[model samples]
Target: MIIWFTTLQIVVAVAAGAFCAIAGLAGRRPSDFSVGALALVEVLLIGQIVMAIVAPFAGNPPSGDPLEFWVYLVSAALLPIGGVIWALLERSRWSTVILGVIALAVAIMLWRMQVIWTVQVG
Candidate 1:
């Protein structure tokens, strides 16, 4: 994984998570802002997916188990989708809070993926 790109993803994810959490704490229901924040995270994950595919060919393949990295990548991609859908269906303040939790989880997962990609040795 590219250090810069991973850092960017982590920053965005944290910001988005905080935004959602604050909104939820303020008793706000699921709104465009909350949903959009998660959507942005999802977009970043999509970019990561593309990067993962290309990085290997660019001679930056994972130093750890490729399967582990792909598992994390795929699971991270699914999180925002589930969160957004839950928010849409529930349309509650807690749903917004759930979005926050999902975003934070994504950030942690991304960090782990970075380790799997570049830090861990086979």
Candidate 2:
């Protein structure tokens, strides 16, 4: 994966996670803003998936297990939507916290995916 794009994904995941967490702490429900933030992350993640497809043909195949890479990619991409669905169903303050936690998980998973893709670190 491209380093800059991966970094951006991680940052966006973390930022969105933190935003939902703060809202949760404030006793607020899952507002549209937070959901929109999750949507933005979802879009970026989809872009990452598309880039993954394009990269191999462009001569940037995965250095690790491609199966694992793809699984992580797909799972991470779906997580936020799942979390939001759960939040809407639960309809509790803890649901906001759950969204925050789910967003954080997306961030963490993206970092792991980068590592599996053999991202070089500073």
**Top-TM-score candidate index:** 1
CA RMSD of all predictions: 0.5, 2.6
Q: All candidates' TM-scores?
A: 0.98, 0.93
- Deviation (Å) of 83 in candidate 1: 0.4
Residues 60-100, model 2: lDDT tens digits: 88888888889999999889889878877777778888888
Top candidate when judged by lDDT against the true structure: 1
- TM-score of predicted model 1? 0.98
Clashing pairs in 1: none
In model 1, which regions exceed 4 Å deviation?
none
**Model 2 weakest 10-residue run by lDDT:** 113-122
Q: How accurate is candidate 1 locally (lDDT)?
A: 0.95
TM-score of 2: 0.93
Q: Show model 2 residue runs off by greater than 4 Å.
A: 119-122
Extract clashing residue pairs from model 2. none
